[model samples]
Target chain A: MSSDAELIGRSLRGDTSAFVEVIRRHETAIGNYLARRVGRQAAEDVLGDVWVAAYESRATYDRSYPEARPWLYGVALNRLRRHWRSEPAEQPAPDLTRLAHDWDPWPAVDARVDVQAPLRRALARLKPEEREVLGLVAWEDLTVAEAGRVLDIPAGTARRLLHQARKALREAPEVAALLQVPTT
Target chain B: MDEMDLMKKLSDVPSPSPEAYDRARAVLETAVAEPVDTVVRPKRWFSWPRAGVAAVGAAAVAATVVMGVTGGSAPTGTSTEAASPVVESPLVKLASEVKAAAAQPGDSSLVIATKTAPDNSRHVYYTLYTDKGQIFTGDSTTLASSVTRNDDQATPYNAKVMAAAREAANGDVEKARIAMITAANNALGVGLDPAAADKAWADTQAEVAETFRKLGKEVPAPRPRPTGKELENRINNHLWSNATYALVVGAANTEVRAGVLKLLATIKEVTVGETDLDGQRVLTITASPDILGGNASAVLTLNADNGLPIRDEVFPAKDSPQPSKHAVVSYESSRVSLADVAAGKI
Candidate 1:
């Protein structure tokens, strides 16, 4: 299989089918990325725009990176912002709201942590960037540096944000139940 | 579970449905398929009318400009209100009423477009449109679970036409006409000053002359600048086709229908009259064979109240043995949920 970088390079050469392969590989990841932030319905609508923007801008892709996933996330984020900007300022971006709409806390792992109130409040209270880095790492399973790449921030800044975010989560009085879980 | 692990568990979302992936892919593919990105400037239809040439013979420059269903460039004696929307026709004024009517509420638009063949058989397409400006296509009449979803594809032209229609919702009909024509083919709307337009038309004339010369065909006499009746025909032709283009893609849009109704009113060649169709009042708007650039004529039947198109047809010149050049089309549009449509509820 061609690396995403190789495919994007091929696509720039006019073999558009190569780009379609890159899309098939990362579409699921991109879908989850948008769904986490904007809900599924909006995600579906914006997903096409992301692909259009990505394809048009493929000439700018830095092919040194074998993985296009982070680059794609960056593209998806730009489109996501366009969707969000249409929304009023007070309605915080929907990153955590998708959870409020769909998450019923996992009772089987440990029913006591099922209290979503503290988790939601704790997540919401962190400065927007810090919460974003945490969500990218925790939910998207991206490395701290990879999260930074998606946000176009330096790795050290991303590390600091993650650290602050974790600390906030641990110290919140409302999050005591979540932290009390014995670390493996 | 660790806090990060807990966050992970809580944030899980379903993978995008195949329909979602197809929709997005279609957008990329449409861009890929276009021969050139027209962002710099809209390209003139490289294909142009070889009309009046002894060589290529009647191959109209594929135009937003009309040369359909009729023959010749002679004006059909309709006077020129084409330049401006002054002296509001009763039909054109109805646009304000239609525009003032509240838009129907819906997140998704469902349009079932049916095309009838000369043989009398029909092909039906089930298309779902998003407010976000995407369309999913399906062909089943009564679909099973296996065939529940629409095929993802939206031509960029369709998006452009609908966007123009939305913009027309409040603007003057003349401006709306130009917007719709430009949306059809960006080249037509650009360079609208009389001098710039005539120069472009002259350049097209030279190109036409060159095309005939290259083919070793005898060159037709040079067409003077497309002015008066000729310019009116081109503008009118582009408007009619683009308006049909808007309705076919987006009749579910109240503003689109209203805009099209308003703009269509301005085409004097388009005659609108009411008729009784099985005890129901319907308006039939016709483009006589003369205006279609030849002998073929177009008729669009609409609901008397809302102006939504019920059926649209084109018939070849009355004497021509060739079957009607275009497939006869009709449609039903409604508000529906994407999930329900995906689940085969329609």
Candidate 2:
């Protein structure tokens, strides 16, 4: 089978069916990406816009990259940003209170006591940019280089952001306790 | 937890439903096919139409001014209120009421509607839309029915029309109007460009003129391209008719029904009056003849207390083949459980 890059090249040359194939390949990943950030309902609404934007801008895709997943992520991120800005500030993010529910993987009872609570707080405290880069690595399974491409930042910058985010989490007393990491 | 562990937890967040993914894919496919510059955003229900009225009305005034200066005999009998810049809030209030009623959760929505066919036979349809997205349809005349779980099959209404109504009710009236306009263009197979008003007018006029010529009728003298007001009115008429159909046939959810009501309120050409339906007091809302594209007009009668449609009446145009005939489709809606529908209890 031709690669995603090849499909996109064909799409740019007027083969819309090729683009549909590309969408089918990435829809699940992209849907997951959106659901995680914006919750499922809003995520579904944004997903359509992401694909449309990607299709319209397919001509500008850099063919050097064999995979279009990172570029698609970038498009999704831009749309998410726009959605976030447009939304009223008073509206709370999707219910993450469930995150603290009993799903602790740690064997120790003491360690199991609401580890996700502090982790959620720690995740929220990171600067938006750092959180985004960390999310790409941790949640989306993107490498620092791939995350950099998604965010349109240099790989070094993405690495620095990810490192900063990890350090911030480690420095937080609650997070450190949850992770059982000794504070320096 | 270590970074990998934290990442694992994050990944544990539930994925979007397959249905959502399918819907998004469909939207993307449709959008890609028709490459328009505008992005379809979730509209805030009531905000859209107010702005639309101002913009379209301004264009109409500008067109009128240009015509006067050029010494062209301006068309007589066009409503000057078309140029009125004030936004009416009565429709907005009614829309809110309808939307509130629609939001009440239910297992299934049952629509009992009777349509008078061109052959003068009245057919009653029983459509049930479950909250689970399943649809069961039956009719009185044919005694024929089917059950399907497809979203597209739940209602025979236009998706775009329902979407516009939903947006309008959600307070994006202007966005809903744009959506309606887009739907109208799609239905008419004419591109009504917002930026290129003259071109839209020229294309529409040319198409109409050609149709007239094909009928061997004398083509009238060519006129100036339609102003934004005229175009807005045309689209709003289409929107109103489609919205009415959606309410009676396809509105499975209250939000959608409410949106259609809200969108309907934005059209100034529609007049709201009071009448008796089956000896019960109802509000009768009628669209103007011009908006309906002929001498015939559409009247939607709704239960005043609940805002649910009671009946839909289509008055035949003066030149219509059935000039003396008018069609009335009465509606009865209720909440029913999915199991009951499955058991054929409806």
Best by lDDT: 1
Per-residue lDDT over A9-118 for candidate 1, one digit per residue giving the tens place of the 0 to 100 score: 67755574788889989999999888767767778988877886777556446665799998899888766655544445575545543422333222211222233656
> lDDT scores for all predictions?
0.62, 0.59
Task: Kindly list the per-residue Cα lDDT of model 2 for residues A40-120, writing each as its tens digit.
Answer: 777877887787768755644666688999999999986665565445647643532332222121222122233477777
Report candidate 2's fraction of native contacts.
Answer: 0.43
Q: Which predicted model would earn the best DockQ?
A: 1
Q: For residues B140-239, write the lDDT of model 2, one tens digit per residue.
A: 3211224422212432224566677667767556657656544534322223333344444455455445534543445545565444566455555555
User: Residues B207-306, candidate 1, lDDT per residue (tens digit)?
Assistant: 5566446444566675433456655666677667667767766677777777787777778788888897768787888887555655467888887777
Model 2 chain B lowest lDDT segment of ten: B41-50
Q: Give the RMSD in angstroms, all C-alphas superposed, for model 1.
A: 18.9
* Model 2 score (lDDT): 0.59
